[model samples]
Target: MSYRWLKWLILWIPTVVIGLWEYVRHAFLLPYVSMELGNWLAPVFVFLITLTLVRRLFAKLEAMQDSLKRQQVVKAAFEEREQLARELHDGISQSLFMLSVKLNKLDRAQSEADATKAMEGVRHTVRHVYEDVRQSISNLQNALQPADSTWLQSIHRLSSELEQAQGIAVTVDSKLYDGLLTNRQKVELLAILREALMNVQKHAGASAVTIQAEHHGALNVPVPAFSCVIEDDGKGATEEELQELGKYGIRMMRERAKAMGWKLNIGPSALGGIRIEITGGGASG
Candidate 1:
């Protein structure tokens, strides 16, 4: 039966049984049965209906709920896969296209200095593409990694990677509870953090980077919001570079923040380099 029909049947069965019993007791049994005996039998009727029909109906409803939950899990997995595909297309694919363009420039260079500049551009594009792919792979691995691996651990891993690969010092100071973020939020936030650090390694010329996250509102209550900051001590960007910051990877970070209903701000850090701030509503999901 349809769900609505099941509900209607469950609701009416008790009433119908009680009404029929009452009618029979008054119309026919009054002559043969005592009032006390009819009153005692009423509870038996209710107990039998609840034990048999109502219990079965409840079981079916529970089964349907479980099936729906399973379907939702499958749907969420598909959605995550789709998101990964989009990230690859927007990031790595674009970098590859840029790499091809740089190659064309290198091929057409007419002078030694021109060829050298073009070669540098080609190298930069190749390095950017490599970082993009490596970051994507690391993110996927983190997703499939054991649940014992916490989000903070992922952050530290990313920091460690940067420090080892680029010889830059990375420090993390996080106060926001992990329970405050959903898994999807944590993933997006991590990607954003990774992109920010890559930008530092590529262009910031910094020696040290700091990542800080702070929770807002009371500890035991619902947090209204939180903020995470990635800052570095390096040569800051010029106005022209700041204006072009939204071109590639930084644009992806902005899109990720927008998807999460968050704000991303880029500015000069007090420590001498750039600062990236991501602010969003606190989470319980």
Candidate 2:
């Protein structure tokens, strides 16, 4: 039954039934029914009503809730598929088109110098396409996997990707506890971290990068505040340079943090490169 029907069943049914019973007992059966017998009959009436109606109604409600949860899961699956389709179209498809154009140019070159330049362009475009494809596959894999995967595992995966793609060294020092971030929080935090690392890969020109995360309050606390820092030992950005090359990624990260009501900071790192820090409260999902 619907919630309103259930509510009426729970509230008004019992009140109306008991009121009618009491009225009959007092007005019509008072000469035959003793007060003690009436008192005992009242509980018996309530018991019969509960056993015959309330129990079945509650079972139906539970079943309805379960069915709703299943539908939500199916809806979420469809949405994920749609998102993957868009990513393929926007990223991998465009990169493949560029790769095809470069191949055409390579094939039409007239001179040795022109051919060599075109070949180099083709190679660059091919590499770009490969990276885009790899990233899409990784994202799809992550989406299909279970939510129990920890932030450390995600960071390690990103580190592996950065190392493979950019030949950069990555070190991770995470002191934040697992099982303390909601799924939404994990997604947002990972997106911010991924963007920050991508900026380092594209602009830092550094050999090594470090990701450090730690809880902010007492270690023994059940739910503590936390912070994450991503930095590199590369040629650091002056404010002006950040405004030029790293602006898009930095702004995206800042927007994510703001959406989550967290704090995001960008500044020069002690490692002589850019530092991106995120701080927020931590609680179990």
**What lDDT does each candidate get?**
0.81, 0.79
lDDT of 2 by residue, 185-243 (tens): 77778878876876776668899999999877665554468899999999998888886
lDDT score, candidate 1: 0.81
Write model 1 residue lDDT over 1-285, tens digit each, in one string.
Answer: 777887888899888988999999999999988999999898899889989999899888788878988997796577557556755776678788988998898899999999999999988888877876776676677656554457789889889988876799999999867887766677778878877887787678899999999888765655458899999999988757965643456776888899888999988899999989999885631
How big is the positional error of residue 47 in model 2, measured in Å on the Cα after superposition? 5.2
Specify the highest-lDDT model's number. 1
**Each candidate: RMSD:** 6.0, 5.7
Structure candidate 1, residue pairs in collision: none
Report residue 115 deviation for candidate 2 (angstroms): 1.6
**Candidate 1 regions off by >4 Å?**
1-91, 109-124, 146-148, 179-185, 198-205, 234-264, 280-285
lDDT of 2 at 46: 82
